[model samples]
Target: MQKDKRTSLTDGMFLSLMKSSLKGISQVILIENAVTGFIILMAITIFSYPLGIITLSSSIIGTLIGKLGGANENNVNSGLYGYNSVLTGIALTLFLTGPSQWFIALVGAALAAVFSAAMMHFMRNTGIPILTFPFIILTWFMLLASYKLKAFQLSPGLVPQDLSHWTLNISGKVDWLEGSFNGIGQIFFLDSTLAGILLFIGVFWAGWKYGLFSILGNAFALLISFVLGGEHSLIILGLYGYNAILTSIAVSIVFKEDHNRFAPISGIIAACVTVPLTASVATWLLPYGLPALTMPFVLSTWLFLGARKVLPRL
Candidate 1:
């Protein structure tokens, strides 16, 4: 009977860890459903098999660190540690190209978990979620490190330019269907139309309301960027849409409190805010050859969430 109990306990722990790792993928979008994460994984794999592997591998690494490091069990199970690692892993793998990129990507993923733990410890009293700040900062640092490191190679798509030479060009026709799907796909650093559709299915699978917010957020961001005369190539490519999708979901659904009565309205506003934020952040990073990543989402979400502390109804 004692041996049987030990075996059962081991199996239970393994199952729990698997579930947490899966939840970590979905948690990238601020959802904690394992099934949703699995669908998202499928979507990612369909577009890039390597990315799909890193996504799940990074999540598992994060969960394992949290589990073994004696962190709060609830936080580990909630997939909080896994999300940052997921983003970090994907970003590093995509932004850096070399034989050692895979190794660096895994290392970055592990560090993301540690970084998230540190951030959580520091922000515990602030009554605000860290969101993907750790991922954003870590990715920027690692990408910048490529400039000095011999083993790290930056992708050709990222080219540093003199601000004096920058020119604004906002002249291209938008592909509505492609833009619609690209927004969701870019969340995982993807641009595949099929992957985007699958991502939407995964989101709706989590909850219809969240799916609605995501669509509304992407649509609003695209429209706002178009009207604001953002570069047509960037707007149509869904560069501006990913941040809005994240902000809308974070503000209205994920971080919302039961007592915050106007969360939905504020959520839309926050989503739209990301359009301009994206342009500004991208331009700021142009000199360094860095993509904006999720800073726009973090900024807009933090804005509304911090405001709600002073006026709880916001």
Candidate 2:
């Protein structure tokens, strides 16, 4: 009887271990979605304007369909369905620079949505993990689109002057520290190195409440972009701000805490990135273009306030 009791206790312990393991897996899956969603949103914001609209619309549609079609909240299948297609659409849009690029962007978005749904369906039925399916489909689609699209040429009027000229013009008028501060203040004015610094400051200060992961992720993505020969433009800096806000929202959802202090502090840091330089640059290049220096901070404030409303309550 004692032996039988011992055996039963061992079985119970094993069952408890299994349950704990499953719970941990579920938590990880949820976190992964949060990360992926932020990444996709950042990608869209980086594209901005009409292209951002197309990418966002396609991703939202695809994610909704996947959720309804049997992709669970914390499953690998859901992540693939939601994020992969978004990346594919954005990538296609970037590669297609023709005058007819708008049409091509829409087509790419459609293709990504349809293919993601179809692939998810296939994987579900076969019981295979949908781990790499999105990457495979997106890569192939982008490659095909690139091959078919001809290079586009822009008129001289549409092209901005050399970076050096802009740099020299700004440097001549504003001292380095003052210029950097202004740049921080006007982060959304365009792509500038000062904007990058502000983003880093936001991530760092937010780390106090949300932990180090948010800052680490932003830095990592930035590092990767720099290594890939991408320009450190103001647009890219704006993208980092977008990324940090989304990440903060995600962490709030998962952890169920406000991190209220973190959000505004981060915003101030983001603002600092552009304020000094953006103001000076606008004054020099387009004296009437105050909007250029101010729009990003306005947008960031609006986005964060709206995020507070839309995000699931912790």
For 69-179, candidate 2 gives per-residue lDDT tens digits of: 654544423344444444444444544466766565555555554675666677555433343245344544454434345543222222334444444221122133333
**Model 1 vs. true fold: TM:** 0.97
For candidate 1, the per-residue lDDT at 98 reads 90
Which residue pairs overlap in candidate 1's backbone? Answer: none
TM-score of 2: 0.36
Error of 1 at 108 (Å): 0.3
Estimate the overall C-alpha local distance difference test score of candidate 1.
Answer: 0.93
| Residue 185 lDDT in candidate 1 | 86
lDDT of 1 by residue, 164-253 (tens): 988998786999779889998899998889999999999999999899999999999999988888887887689989999999999999
lDDT for residue 181 in candidate 2, whole number 0-100: 28
Backbone N/Cα/C clashes per model: 0, 23
RMSD for each of the candidates: 1.3, 17.3
Candidate 2, residue 1: how far the Cα is off, in Å: 67
